[model samples]
Target: MEQDLIVVGSGNAALCAAIAASEKGARVLVIEKAPEDMAGGNTKYTAGAMRFAYDGGEDLQDLLLDPKDERLPRTDFGAYTAQKFRDDLLYFNDGRPLSPEQDKLVGRSLETMKWLAGHDVKFEPIYARQSFEKDGRLVFWGGLTLAAEDEGVGLFEAERAALLRAGGRIEYGLAAQSLLVEDGRVRGVTARREDGSTVDLRAQGVILGCGGFESSRELRHDFMGEEWEAARVRGTPHNTGDGLLMALELGAARHGLYSGAHATPMDRHMKEYGNLDIPHGDRKNYRKICYFLGVMVNAEGKRFVDEGKDFRNYTYAQYGKAVLDQPGQFAWQLFDAKTEDLLYAEYRFHDAHYVQADTIEDLCAKLEGVDASAALDTVRAFNAAVDDDTPFDPTIKDGRQARGLTPPRSNWAQRLDTPPFRAYPVTGGITFTYGGLKVDDAGAVLRPDDSPIPGLFACGEIVGGVFFNGYPGGSGLTSGAVFGRQAGYGAAASLSPAT
Candidate 1:
C-alpha cells in the first residue's frame, strides 16, 4: 500500500509535517522508532519555550489565551523584533549575514507560532525560567517569554491531537532503515518493525525528521571530539543519526559546524540516557542552570569561561564544551547565600549532586573532585575583583563585572563573602548536533551542487546550517516548526499535478 506522504520520526517536526500534509488532503503516514510512551523524540525532554519576534506586550497579548487579565499592567515583556531575531541568529553565526535558508526560518517564525496556536497549541509566559517577580510584578528578561502551555509534553500531545484530528496515522515501533530511491528520486522507505520484520512503505514523498547523532558515542567521539563520549544524552537514545545517515547515503550535502552541538550543563549523576520512566517535570530537572548567578570552577580549581558573559540563554549551549575540557570532564558551580534565593527550579531537585556549607572554606572541603586549597583561593581572588560600586540586579545586565580577574565574570558579579555557600557538580549534556543535511528555504534536501533532491524533504534537527557554535535558548523548537511546515507543504505540492 502507498500513501501521499511518509513522515519518519514522531517528534514536533514530523508531527507538524504530517498534519500540514493531511490538511492539504494528502494521506500522511508517520513512522516512530520508539513505542507510544517515548514517541516525541527530543521534543519530549524540552522546556517547550518558543522564541519568535514580538513587537511588545500588546503584540504578545494577541497570541495569549488570557490577555485582558488585571495582572497585565504589572508585567513587562520587552520587544523582540524581527531585526533582533536576525541579529541574534547572525551573532552566533560569527556576525555573518543570514543565509537565505536562515532568513526564511527567522522571517516565518511568528507565522509558525500563529499557525500552531490555530491548531490549539496554547502559549503562555515562561515564568519559572525566563522571568522574575519584582515588586509584585513579573518581568520577563531575555528575549524569550512565550512557551507551550504545559511545556514539552504539552506541545507534543497537542500536535498529536491535531494530527489525528486531520486524519493522519502514526505507526509506532517501526524504525526507518533506509530510503527507497528509483530513477534518482525518493519513493518511500524500508522500516524495521519491532518484531524484526521488514516492510516497504511507499509514499509520494518522504520527510526525515529523526534528529542528530548526540546519542551515539562513536559519532560523538569522531565528529564532536573525544571528550563528548562521556557527555550524557539529554534526549532520546533512538536519535543515533539514522535520518542523517540515510540522507547522506543518497548524496545529500552536509552543512554547518560538524564539531559543534547544543550542549548544556546538566547534573553529573543523572541517568546515562533520558529516562522514560520519570515524569516530564522530572526530565527538565537534570539541567543545572543559574550558573550566571554564581561562578563555575574546574576540577583544577581555576575559572574557565566567563559565567556572565551574556544571558544564560546565549552562552549555556557553548559553555558545555568548556566543562567537557576540564580535568575529569567535569566542573562545579558555586553560589553564595545572597544569590541562593534567585536560583532556578532545577537547583532544588532531590537527586542533584550538591553540598552546602556555612563558609567558603568549609564549602571547598565538601567539593569532592575539586582541589580544596585551590578552590578556596579561586573564590577569594574572584571576590576581591568584584566591582562593589555596581549594585547587583538579576533581572537585567547590571555592569557589576569583575575587574583584573582571569576569565573574568562580565556581569552580575557579587562578592561570595556572604556565609553559607552552595555548590553543584556538573557535566556536559548534549542535546543535538549542528551538522546535518543541507536544505533549501522550503526544507527540500539539497545536493552538493545546490540542487534539490526530488521527493526528499527534511525538518527539525535533521535540517542543518541554521545554528552554528552557540544557540539562543528556545529557538530550536521555533526553527523546527517553521521548517517543518514548509517541508510538509513542499512535499505535498511537489506531487500535486500527479496526485
Candidate 2:
C-alpha cells in the first residue's frame, strides 16, 4: 500500500500528526502494533492532564476552568508565562539549558493546545486531581490546569474521531519493522502483520510516535538496570522499543538520558502488567502517588525521600525509583485522618494495598515487612519535629515544615497525631523510557551527522530530550500535542505532491 505519509503508532501524537497531514490534503496511513482494542499507546493509560502556559484565572477560564463558577471567588491560578515554563524545563535538568528543539516545544505549547481544542477535544479544569479548596476558593497549583473532558481514553477517542473525519486511515496489529530509505530519504515503511506476514507501505513521509521500552523486560534491564525488570508496567505491554530500534538501525542519533524513565509509586499488589480488562474509568487506580501529602517509610521503618519536598506531581515520577531501591523494593505511605480527606482519588480504590488502624503503633505493626519498633519511633520523631507554629495548608507552599529531621518535611508538615492512621504499600511502576531518536524543532528525525533525515519525523515518547530525572505533571500530553502537530505539518511540507 502507498500513502503520502505513514505514521507508526496509533497514540495521541501519531493521531495528531495524521490528522494534521490529512488536513493538508495528504493521504495518511497509521500503523499500530496493538490490536484495535489496545490502541492509543501509553496515552490511553494516562490521566490526560495537560500543562500549558496561561496568564491567570481569566485566561485559564477559556481553556479549562470557569472563572465565574460560584464556588471560587478568591482562587488564584497565577500567570504561568512562557518564561516560567522554560525555567521549569531547565530547572529539572539541573539548570542545564534546553536544546533549540526543546525551546521550540515550550514556545509552541499554548498555541498547540488551542489547536487541539479547536479540533473538538473539549478541555476541562482538572479540579479532582490538580486543585483544592483553600480559604473558600478553589486554588489550582503546579501550573497544571486542564485535562481532556473524560481523561486519557476520552482524549484518545476524540483524537481518533477527528483523524477519521479528516480522512486518515489506520491499520491495527501491523507493526513497522524498518524504514525504507532511498537516496538518503525515508521512502516508506516495511511492516509485519500479527500473522507474521510482511507488507511494504510506501510513503513520502514517516512519523514515529510509538512509545519507549518501558514494557520490554530485556530492554528495561539493559537500559535502566536489572531492577527495572521487576518494575510493573504502568501502560501498554507493546512498547518494546520497536520505533526506537527501527530508527537506530537507520543511523538516527540517540539522545537524552537513556537510563532514566518516568516512573511512579503504584500499588504493590496490582498486577505486574497493566490489565486492559480493568474498567477504563478505574485503570488509574493502581497508582498510589499522594505520598507528598504524607510520609514514605521503607522496610527498615526509615523515612527515605522528603515526602513534603514538593508537590506530588512534581516528585512522584522519580520517587518510584527510590521505592524500588528499598530493602524489599517497596515502601509504605503513611497518613492520618487529619489529611485523610486530602488523599488523591486513587487511594480510595477498594483493592488498594493499604491498612488502617486507630493507633500509629497498630498501623505500623500491620505493615508487613516493616520494622514495628523503628516504625513507631520514626513516626514519633517526625511528629516531634513538626513546627506546630506553622499553619497547615495544602493549596500552596505553606512552609509548614518539620524542624531538625534528617530528611526534613519541607512543606505541609503535620504531625500524625490525628488518630485513624492509614498506610498504602507501593512499588515502582515504570511509565516510559526517556531516550530515543533525536529530532529537530520541526520534528524531523536527525541523522548521526545532526542533519535532518529527509521525509522522516518523530514525536511523543519515542522522541526524547524534553525530560530527564524530574518531570512536572501534565507536560507529557502537552509536548505530544505540540510536537505531533509540528511533525505532521513538516511531513506534509516535505512532500513533492504529484511530482
Candidate 3:
C-alpha cells in the first residue's frame, strides 16, 4: 500500500507519530515486531505514570477520564513547573547541562499531555502508588501525579484507538529490517512478516520509534558491562536495538550514554522478560520500589546505598544498577510491620517473593546467601541510628534520619524493630537502553555533522541524548509522546506533495 509515512514501532511513540502524521493529511502505516496481542513494546510493561509539568490540579482535572471523580476536590495535585521538571532531569544528567532534547521534553510536556488528551487518551491521578493520605486528604509528592488510566495497557489501547480513528493502519508481526534509502534519502523500509515473507514498502518518510537494546544481552554486555548480562528485562524482549542498528547502518550518528540505562529494582526471580499473560495492572507488580520505607542489603549482609537519600522516584532507576553490581546481583528489602501498610501493592502480589520472620534475628537468619551475623549487626546499627525524635511522615521528606553510620540514611529513616519483619528479594531489571540515534529538535535523524537525514525522523527510545546515567520516574512515556509528536509533524512536513 502506498503511504506518505512509515512508522516502525507500535508503542506510544510510534502510535503518536502515526496519529499526528495522519492528522496532517499524510497516509501513515505502522509496522510492529510483536503480534497484535503483545504489540505495544515496553509501553505495556509500565505503570503508565507520566511526569509532566502542570499548573495545578485544575490542569489535571481537565485531562481526567472522570473530571468529577470525588477525589478531585480532596486530592492535592501540586503544581510541577517547567523549571522543576528541568531540575529533575538535570539531577540525573551526571553534572552535564540539559541537552536540547531534554529542554524540548520539559517545555512540551504539559502541552503534549493536552494534545494526547485531545486524542482521547484519558489520565487519572496516580494515587495508589504516588500519594499518601494525610490530614484527611491525599497529598502527592515527587512532582509526579498523573498516570494513564488503567496504566500501560490502557494507554496503549487509547493511543491505538486514536490512531485507528485518524485512519492510520498498523501491520502487526512485521519487523522492520532496513531502510530503503536512495540518493541520500530514506524512501521507505524493508520488513519481514510473521509468515517469513518479505515486503519492501515505499513511503515518502520513515520514522523509527522502535525502542532500545535493553532486551539484547549481547548489546547490554557490549555497551554497559559484563555484569549487565545478568540483569533481567523489565519490558518487551523484542527491543533488541533493531531500530538503532538500522539507523546506524545508514551512518546515523550514535548519541547519548551508550553505557547508561533505565534500570529498576524488580523481583529477583521474575521471568527474563515481562509476563504478558497476566492482567495489565498486575504486570508492574514485579517492581519492589518501596525501599524508602525500609532498607536494602546486598549478599554480604551490609547496606549498600543510602536508602533514605531521596524519594524512590529519583533514586530507583540508578539503584537497580547498584543491585546488579552487588555480590550476588541481588538484594533484599527489609520492612517491619510499622511500615507494612505503606508498602506499594506490588509487595503483596501473589507472585511477589519475600521472607518473613517474627524477630529481627530470625529475619536476618532467613536471608539466604547473606551473612546472618553481619546482617543482624547491620539491622541493629540501623535501628540504633534512627532519630526516633523526628516524627515519621511519608507525605514529604520527614528528615527522620539514621545518622552516624558508614552510609547514613538521609531521610525517612525508621527503626525496623517492629515485628514481624518481611524481606523482598530483588535484582536489577533493565527497562530501556540510553544509547540511540541522534535526532534534531524536529525529530529528524541526524548525520555526524548534525545535519538531518532527509526523509528520516526518529522518536521514543530510538532517539538518544535525552537520558544519561539515571532517569526520573515516569519520564519515559512523556518523552516518547513528546518526541513522537515532533517526529510525526516533521515526517509529514518532509513528505513530497505528490506522495
Return the TM-score for each candidate structure: 0.97, 0.96, 0.99
Better of 2 and 3 by TM-score: 3
* Inter-residue clash pairs, candidate 2: none
| Per-model CA lDDT versus the true structure | 0.87, 0.85, 0.91
Give the poorly placed runs of model 3, Cα more than 4 Å off.
none
Best-performing candidate as measured by lDDT: 3
Alpha carbon lDDT at 387, candidate 1? 94
Alpha-carbon deviation at 156 in model 2, angstroms:
0.6
Candidates ranked by lDDT: 3, 1, 2
Candidate with the greatest TM-score versus the true structure? 3
Number of clashes found in candidate 2: 0
Candidate 2 at 384: error in angstroms? 0.8
Q: Comparing 1 and 3 by lDDT, which wins? A: 3
> What tens digits encode model 2's per-residue C-alpha lDDT throughout 1-499?
4689999998888899988888888899999988999999988888888888877766655555344666556665667788888877776787667866568777888888878877877777777888887667778888887888778898999999999999899999999998998888899899999999998888888999898888899998887798888899999988999889888888889988898888899999988777778777678889988887787899999999888887787888889888999998999999999887888778887777789999998999999999989989999999889898988878788889888888888998888888889999999999888888788767899988899988889988888787887688788888788889989988888889592
| Every model: Cα RMSD to truth | 1.4, 1.8, 0.9
Model 1 TM-score (2 dp): 0.97
Candidate 2 ranges beyond 4 A from true positions: 61-75
Ranking by TM-score: 3, 1, 2
Clashing pairs in model 1, backbone N/Cα/C closer than 3 A: none
